[model samples]
Target: MSHAIGAPLIWWVSDYTLANESALIVGDDFGSIAKVKLESETGLKDIEIIQQNNQQLSVRLPATISYHSHALRLYQPDLKTFERVWLNAPKIDWLQGDMGVKTSTGQGWLQLSGKNVDTLNLQDAFLINKTGKSYSLSLKESDPWHAVFNLPKQIPVGSYQLKFGQKVTQPTIPPLEVFIVNQPTDFQQRVLNIKDFHQSEDSIDHTIAFKTALADLATHGGGTLYLPAGHYRLSNSLFIPKNTQILGDGNLATHLIWSKIDKQESIALINLEDNTRLQGFSMYHDDAAFGINSPSDRVINNVHIEDIVIRMSAYRGHPTSEMLTKIYDQILKRFSNKLDTIRLQANNITLKNNDIYGTGRSFAFIDSHGINIQNNKFYNGRRGWYSFSGCSEIIFRNNTITGADLMASGGGINTLGNKVSSRNLYFANNTLGMFNGWDREAFTSDGGGASYFGHVQSHKENQLLLATNLRSKGLRLTPYEGAVLFVVDGKGVGQYAKVISMSENLVHLDRKLDVALDNSSKIIICPLQENYIIVNNTISDAAIGIQLYGTGLNHVVYGNTSIRTGGINLLGLWYGGYQSAWYTLVAHNALYGSANTRKFNPTRTDLHTSNITVEARPRSTDELNLVYGIVIRNNQLYQNNGVSIIGSQNARKNMDAIFVDPLDN
Candidate 1:
C-alpha cells in the first residue's frame, strides 16, 4: 500500500452489459494489485483481472468495446498508475425525430433516445440557450442506443437545455423551442393583405399598420393576415407569431376597436402563438379585458378560435338594467380580479362559432390540452363563465349558456384541477338557463352545477398491493408514463388502471385489481379525472344541474334534462385532497325541480330539492369520502329530491347517504 495519499477509492461500479459480462469494482485501500487498463476511445487495452481482495476488483470483459463508457486503470506493485474508475455513464432518455426532421417542413433534426446514446461526445454535444447560449451538436447517426443530432439551422425562439458532457438535463413538459423555417415561394406570398398594410375603416391608429403586417408575414415564413371589411383601431397588444393566421371579414364584418381599456393593459388583446389562428373577428372590449390570450407559460400548440365575437362595449345597458348592474359591479373591481373573455393557455385548442357577450368572464382554459368548446354562445355575461383549470382532452359541445350570474358569484362551468388533474371530458349538447332575454340563472357556485374538480393523491390504501405496482408521487411526478390509476374511495372503489410503466416511485399498472385495495382505499394517480361524458345537457334555472366534484373513472350522467335546476350533483368532496367519486352513471334524466325541495322531500315545496345527489363528504377520521360504483337510474323526478346517497353504508345518518332504489322494479 502507499499509505493513502492519492488514488484508491472507487466506491462502487458494475455495468458491463451484453448481459452483465462482469465488472464489480467496489472501493477503499487495496494494497497489492497489479495491472488493469481499459481507457476507451481506442487507446489503452490490457483487461482481465478476474478476482482480487483487499476491497474488491473482478474486471474481465473487453470482448470488443470502443466507446459508450470505459476508463479504469488501477496498476500498482510499481508500474505506477494508481486508480481512476468511470464505467458506463451516459443516459439521455427521450428526444425523438430527426435526420432531416420536418416539424411540418421547418426542419431541424434531433433523435437522442436513451442509454449510452452512442456515447454522445460530438465535442460534448450542446444546445443550452435561455441566455447562456451554446449550440454545438452535429453527429448524424450513431446507434447502440440511438443518436441522430444536427439541430441548429437558426435556433432562436426560446427555451433549450441538453448539454450531455457535464450533464444538465431535467426540465421537460413542452419547452424545447429550436427553430428553422424558410418556406414561401409565392402561394400568394402566403397572403398578408391588411390592405397591403394600411387603410382599414380608418379610425386610424391601426397599431403601426398592424405591426407592419405582422413583420411582413414574419419574413415570409408564416401566412394569412387578411382582415377585409374592417373597422380596426387597436392601441397595442398583438404578438400572434408562429404559423400565424388572424383572418376576418364576418363576425359582423370584422370590427376590432380595443383602445386598450384605458391602458390597464394586462396583456392579450390578441397574443397567441404556435400554429395560431383567430378567425372572423369582432372583439369589442370596453373595460375588463383579455379577448384572446394564450401562452401563460408555454405549451402553445395548435390553437384556433373561429367566428369570434367577444363583446362588452361599455354596458349597452338593460339586460335587466341597473346600468347593467353598475357595469357588473365595476367589472368586478379590476386589478385582476379575474376576467376572461377567452384566455386559453393553448394545446390543440379549437373554440368554435364563438359569441361571448357582455360584462365579463366567458372562457378560461388554463394549463390546457386538447379542448374544443363547440358552437358557443355564452350570453349577457357577468358570469357565463366557462373556466377550466389544468385541463385535458375536453369537448364542451353545442354550448349556449345564457345568464350565469347577474351579481353574486356563480358561473356556468368549472373544472378544478388547478395544478394538474383533469381528464377526458365531453360535456355534450349544452344549453344552460335563462335564454336570450338574459336576466340571470345559469347558476353554479363551484360544484353546485357543471363543476368537475379532480386530482386526489392517496388518502389511504396503506401501501396497497393488488398484485404489484402502486408507487405514488413521492417524487411529485416526472414519470407520468401513461397516467391514470383510479380507485377513488374504499377498497378498490370502482377500480381503474392504465399506467404501464413508471419509476422514481413506481406505478406499473396496465391491469390487476378487480377489487382489492386495503386501508379503506381512496387513490388517484395522475393529474386526475377519468373518462367523463355528461351527455344531452339542457339545464334551466340552475342552482345545481350537473356536478361531479372529485371525478374519476367512467362518468356518464346520461340523457340529461333538468329544467328548474338543482338536479344532477354527485359530490364526493375534497378540501385538502382525498377527493372521491368513481364509476358514476346517473341514468335517463328529466329531473325538473326548483321550489326549495330539501334533500329528498322534507315535504317538498313542489320540486327541486337536490334532485339527484350522491354526496359522500368525509374530511377526516382517516379519510375516505366515497361515492363508489354509483348508478342512479331511470330518473324523471318532477317535484324533486329523488336519488340521494349522502355519506354511505345505506344512507340516512339522520337522512342522506344511501337510498339506492332507482326503480329497476
Candidate 2:
C-alpha cells in the first residue's frame, strides 16, 4: 500500500473472516469505498472497509471481485514478533506489480510514504525489537521534554522497532537501532602523563582539538568525547555543543591548566551551556571573567560549574576611582530585565570549596540568578563574589572570606552595580573576616554618578534575605571600616530597597582616623527615590546607625537600638529638587549613651512626617527641623543623647511635618 505524507487518518478496518461460501467484514465507514476479498481464484474483488471515522460497518461477501468488490485485511499484533504500526494508515493510491505476494498469513501491506504526523496523533511512542527488546519514544530534546538523563548501565545490543505514541493517534517511526559499546575502565582509558606527551602545549591547539572533536562526533554520528585522567595544558577558549556530554576522567588526577599566560579576555574554561554539567577534574584560571556564564534562555537549562577552583590571574590595574567606576558600569548593564531563573536552571552553581582570588575584578558572579558561593575562600583580590544581574532571591551564604580588606581598591560582596530591580535575594550565615585591602568591611557600594546627578540614576534592585553570619571580631577595615550593612555611593537614586531582616549576625567596623570619611556607608542612598526599612537589630561600634541623603523619599527607620556610646551623628532630613522625601517617620526606640554619644549638641529632635506609622518608647539626642510630611508620633522616651533633632547652620525649613503621641498608649 502507498500513502502521501500529511494525509488525515479517517478510517480503519474492524474485522474480516470467511464462513464457507461467504466472507464477512466490519468497521467504521468514512466516505471512501470499502473492499473485501476471498482467496479462491483470481485476485481481491469486493473489499469492505470502514472509511468514515468514529463509525462502524459490517458486511457479507463472496469469493471474487465479481462476486464481492474490495477487501479489508485482518490485522493483529503478533505477540512474539516485532511489528511497526503506521499512523494515519496511508491510502493505496494505485497498487502496481504485486510486491507483497505471499498471501497465506494475511500479512497486508501498509503504506507509509506521507502522512500529517500531527493529525496522526502520534505521541507517547515506544520501540520493540525482534528479540523482545523495547525503547520508549519521546519528543525533540528540550527543557520541557528533557532527555532521559539516567542511562542504564547495561543493555543488550541489537535492532528495535520504534512504536508510535501509545495513543489513538500513534504512528510507528522507522525503528532506530543502537549499539551499546562496552566503555573501557577508568584506568585503561586514562590518557598517559600529559607532561610526557607535551609538545609545546598551547591554548589554541587544545581549543582546535575540542572544536574538531565536537564536529567529528556530529558529522560521523555522535558519541561520548572523553578526556581521561591526566593534566592537559590549554591556552585557548573551548566551545561545547548542546545534546552532547564532554566527559572527563572523574579523578582529581585529571586536570586542565591554561597555558596561555596572556590574553585580554580568555573565554570560559568549561562552557556547560543550556542545562549541562561538568563534574570531575580541577580547572585553574586566574584573572578571567566567568568559569561559566549560564545560558540566557530559560529553555536552556542546568548549567553547573562545580568542583573547580577559578583563580583570577593576579594582574595589576590602576585601582583608581575611575577604574572601579568603569568596571561597575559593565557589571550593571549585563544583569538587567531577566525573569525567574529557577535555581535548578541556574542553581547548585557551587563556587564551593574552591579558591577564587587576586583577579582584576570579581571572582565569580551570577548576573542572572540562582548561585551559591559557600565554603569558598578569597585572597588578595578585589571582591570575592559580585553580581547585579537580577538575583531575585539568591545570595552568598555560609562562606569564609579571609582577605576581605579592600586593596585601597574595592570591597567584599559588592552588588551596588545593579540599577534594575532584583527581587528576593538572600544573604545568610556568611563570614567576612580579618583581611588586608582598601575597604575592609563586607558591604555593597552603589555605582555612583554615571551621567547626571545621583537623583536621576536607576536604583539598586535587591530584595535581600539577610541571615545571621557573624562578620564581627575577626573582620578588620584598615583604610576605613565600621558598620556592615552599608553602601558608600548612592547610584540607584530612585531605587527603593526591599528590606534588611536582621537577627544574629555580628558586624564590626574599625574607626580609622577621620571616621567621617570612612563613615560614608552609614548613609543609605535613596538616589532618585528609594525607601529603606530597618528593624529590631543591634547597630553598634560605629559612628552612626543609618544615614540617608539624596532625592529619595518616605524612608522609615525604626526598631533599631543604636549602642553608639561614642556619639550618634545624623543628616537630620533634607529635601532637594523633585526628590523631596515625604512622610519620613522615626519612632519607638532606646538611645542610651554618654553625652558625647550625642554628636550634634543642641540638635533638632522635635520632628513631623505625613501619613505613616511610628510607635514605641524612645531615647537619644538631637532636635527637629520643621519639615512637612515628617510625622513623629508614639510611646516611651528615655535619657536622651545628641540633639532631640538638630536644625544646623545653613539648614533650610520644611512644611507641615508634625509630631504626636497616641494618648491611649
| TM-score for each of the candidates | 0.32, 0.37
Q: What is candidate 1's lDDT per residue for 1-665, written digit by digit as tens? A: 33346455553343323322445564444446788887655678887776666545666556676445666678787867567665655544334332112121124555543334465464567666667878776787664434667766766644556665542221112233433344422324488778777765544878778889888788877788888896888777787767878888879998988666434454557777777778887887666566777767676777778898877645553456777666557766752436676777766577788887755566677767656667988764554455676565565678887664443223533344335355556566788765222222343313211111133333223222332223332233443444556654444344566555555434556665534456455455544555565677787765566766654545566677887766777665554444556555566678765633223455545544646777776544433435554545456776635776556444322111122333320
| Cα lDDT for residue 282, candidate 1 | 86
Which portions of model 2 miss their true places by more than 4 Å?
A: 1-209, 214-227, 243-252, 261-267, 270-272, 285-301, 315-353, 364-367, 380-385, 404-418, 449-665
Best candidate according to TM-score: 2
**Cα lDDT tens digits for candidate 2, 497-613:** 222222223122222111122211212222222222222333333223333322223334444454432221223232221122333444444454422222233575632111122
RMSD of each: 21.4, 28.9
* lDDT of every model, 2 decimals: 0.58, 0.33
